[model samples]
Target: MTSEELNSNTTSKTQDNALGPAVQLTDEELSANPEYVLEQTLSTILSRPVVCDEESDVDQETNALFTDDDDGDNADGNQRTSNENNRHKQSDSPQTGLSRWKPTLHKPAPSIYILCSLMSVKVLAENLVLGVITDLTLAKIQKYYEDNERQSQKEFAKFQSVTSVIQGLLGISLCSKYGHLSDNHGRVFVLQICGLLTILGSLANLYIYKDSTTYEFYSFVFFYCIEALNAGQMSMVAVGNSYVSDIVSEDNRMVCISFFMSIMYATIGIGPLVGSFLVKIFKGNSFNTLYVALFLNVSYTLGVEFFLSESRTVNERRESQSQYHNEVLRKNLRKEQAIFSKESSKWSKVYHLLKMDTLIDLFKPLKTLWVPKTALGSLVPRINVLILVIIEMFVGGSVEGSVQAIVTYSMFKYSWSSVEIGYYYSISGVGRALVLLLAVPQLISFLKRRNYVALPDSIDRIDMIHLYLFLIFVITAFASMIVYETNDIGSYLNSLFISLSAFALPTVQNGVIKYASKKSIGQVFAAMAVLRHLMSLIAPPLYLQVYAATAKTFPTLFLYIPIILSALSLVLLQFVKIVKDHDMLRRQSEASFNNFDEHINNYSVNTKPNTSFDIANNLKNGKSNLQSNSIPIETTPLFKKSHFTGKDNIRNSYKSLRNSFVNSNTPSSKNSSLDKLKAQNFSAFNVPPSV
Candidate 1:
């Protein structure tokens, strides 16, 4: 009846769909026809229609529909339907040796989307205000309409370009740091910090330039500081994606992320409209609009600080576990510190900081290649995978860069005003948002139902994204060439292209984030953010240069640049092969560790050192070393009566065995931890056969 009620029913339907045919099949019937039952279960679970040969026995429900027709005609109808179903289930069995890559995530609660909505509103307002700032303050912004070759226009352009580059440079180091920090600390904490800093920087900018008559390099300093401290828009997008990754399952992840991104675009679409409304209300006073945006940003930060529930309150590695496990880990870690570092004080913060051992921390993620449970191994089959992903983002960035160039083209080619550009941007945003929110999910669902695509074991649901990207870019590029001649129709088509991009871009980015574990999502997103910022540094300058060079002579051919970049991205995507499943490797590692731990634990309990013969002989030989009061034999809790003999080394034996058992259970480990424990500790305890 209501949207909430509709959502509830829809969620129930999906949940119901996930169950296999066991609910419908009787135990006696299943036992009598096990193969048929298996087939039915597989069909239900895989969401494929029933597939059976015409000669095969039909269940009564299936035969009922065809009862109205002749038996021969009914059989023919059934045959066609069954054949199509059969075609869909070719890769359903594991013996087929392949299925697509889609890494599962821990399902988070519903409150996260509310958080996304808040952040999106903040971003929409923030970016909209930033976009209008240069328009409001730069002297050349108005002069572009009056003078064809204005000196003031060139100076303003130079200033904007230089500052954009500087801001990008400033974001690079800090963006990477945020990723690593979020991974180590927690995503929500870093996100809140980023939000706070962004508000501070924006407020500082307002303080500097609120009443200023003109833009200056000094005014740009506040913006640069924002980029350096907060990582600008990249921080929000990166950490926001990380937050989503923490909660959504693999099945729903792509759609959920798209939905999240759509909300961002949707809100961003609303931002300029709101700003434009404000401008009209104040009779086009852009100065007051900037301060209003600053005040709104401050409110968003306070909202984030108070309202956002942390996605990872415990250590991210143990986020899936209950609070009890988190306490257990902390307790174990404390015990380990107390035992290992005898001289170190328990409360020594300086000593703990010194002991963090960050020498190889930057390269710590690379160690994940050895962990088979994770998707990282398959995600990066070769260095080429990383290269392909980065190149794809780079090309995508370059194509998106055309939007800004188009604004300038609207000024130069169509003589459109800033207000018109704002309107055009809003329209494009809506188109993009619609495609992401409505169209893309429908497409995925349509394909998912048919099950026609043979997704590789290491690839994801939308692996075709890069291939489609090549087409989208080429189309957009071709459209851009004729946009000047085509007028309104051309502009609408270009907006459509941007909308198609909104639908497609998240799929490509999802491929990268999907491979990362919940713990590493922040780091992966951070890498993406850094790449995006790096691309931002390159794309804008390059696009402007190309536009400036070709504006009068052949503005139509300007679309070819993005086409070439997209073509290169497609080529890069082709070389990136999906690797074999590495999750099995992780499972095997877990099994081995479990086995090794069990064996050691059993050995500690079951081992009985036969010092009895040696002790009896020592006593028989008139208390050689056993009767020596100086040689105190410390007791093993399990082997209390067991005594030292020969050289009175029982204390050494107990200490080594205690060290072995205690150290093995510590959370972190060196390479070959089990093997080293076996060799060093087990050997010390496993008494010589000669004895």
Candidate 2:
């Protein structure tokens, strides 16, 4: 038979009644005619509905799958019945295929992986380019000094110090601003801006050192300015962390962040190898690295624009914008209604510009680190936030200083080339990355499985332990460096120790998140970025200058800086406390109680009286009996309306009254309940005393 004829016959039989038996097609006809076979197969498959756990999304797919036929009311009824059957089946089975994958697309794993890939590529490119630039700069300075060792070294140190200061100064404001913007706009938005800036900086770097015959020191400094405009490297770190925070829940945030951080460090380790290979291929030319860096930056920016979804929802963005605008309006209104007169002259304007308040405005972003008083009026959150900030500063400074001190010290003392220095950093990076990736997650999982660190309180304590261990490792490593100059073996041990200290920042961040609200995550990380830039400003000058001055006498004197910072951090970590959000707990309890009360009230009001109960009949008799009383019921105090102070009391009173009425209607109890009811007070129920 023809395919059309076969399909028409099958539809006619099926549409007569949906409850009818199936029409079986002959196997020979199904096999012999491809058209009929295909039609029958599709009809069978489409007739059976696609079932999934997520009914809402899957229902859309199911609707789109079915095509309507123009055959009349019978066909329409059959189609409707089929849809209903599909829905029923969907309710029974779990979701599969694309629908299942869609739910997890927004989950933490995919987000972390995306972020890691983006950051690793960016870091890898950066390390390659930056290493080449540093070597080129050193070579250029050596020429100006005519190969004078001390003079070239001093110039390089000064160059490093100046660039760091400039980057820090710009980064302080930019990082905080970008962070605030990310909270309102989106994390991906900030990342895109930073990525574009990074690409520009790479282009500028290429232009500055395009020619081997001349070096543009001023131009190179401007290049640093461009990078620092988006808070330099720290901006990416802050935004990336905030992005992770947006996706991951508090329970798993620490582990995910550590893993994220580990990936970045792992990239740091791997970047050098890639960079060195590039340098080797280009025959010692570093300029090619900039091209590669620029390419990576462009690719990353495009990826972010296309692939990454915004973490903040439309409602969240709107709410954040509303709050921000309202705050700005309030501030503006306050300024307009000033208690003091406005400045009337240029001198006054100058005075205003130099005012302490004006200076304080520059540091206003740091206020985010101080937890504001909530409705609960708790001091613990504020204290914990402060402690976390303090720990971050000390620990962050030490870490930053150690990086500079170690690199400069290695370069000068061991006379290591750029490649050798890269190798050293790579070794440390690998060690850190492995521990954070492999060990940290397993440890967290083990603890969770054992039920040791279950709640936020327990998590806080674990963070403290991690911090303590990190500080101990840092102290031991740096202190050992102070005692004896590091050889290859010493460097290996030091890297191992430093690698173990990787737990500090991630743990400290977890603590910070615990104290801060979810909305303020961007601001919190921005404040952290600010602190890191502040360290960058202070650390480079202090460590590099100290190393420059004492290189010949005691190069290891700068090592003391990190040791001191770590020691101070270790001491301050003791003051950190774990406090639950009492306000949130109280709100949750009150809401639960209200929900229960509402349910009980709804039950009491809507429940119908059963014909088996004689309460309705009794009410009529009691009313008539009361009306016939010789003493009027109007003057009786028991008949007056009363207010119930407690809902619980009202509910209990109603339940008791209901039970008494039910018992009074029964043949087994009969008048026994009536006597008890007469003795019982009904004032709590706002009814007259029982008759």
lDDT, candidate 1, equals 0.54
lDDT per residue as tens, model 1, 1-691: 3334533532332212111121232233323332232223223322422222222223322232112223535544554565555545432321110112323223334366667766875776576666566665463344434544576677667676677666776566576667765655556567667767767766666665554434455655555456347777766777787777777666666777788888888887887777777888889776687778777777776565555655654434333222224545775686567657867775654444565534333333333322243312332443434644655566667666777777787677778886677677777788778877897788778877777342422444355653465456456644664755657456555766666666555666566554444455676667666667767877776787888898888875556777676666666666665544444223222222332222222211122223444322322332223224222222222222332331123334433433443333332432333454455434312211111
- Give candidate 2 regions above 4 Å deviation: 1-110, 139-157, 212-216, 339-362, 407-420, 457-459, 482-488, 544-571, 580-691
Backbone collisions counted per model: 7, 1
- Candidate 2 — which pairs collide? 53-95
Which ranges in model 1 have alpha carbons more than 4 Å from their true place? Answer: 1-110, 139-151, 212-216, 223-228, 317-380, 452-457, 465-488, 551-554, 578-670, 683-691
lDDT of each: 0.54, 0.62
Which residue window of length 10 is worst by lDDT in model 1? 91-100
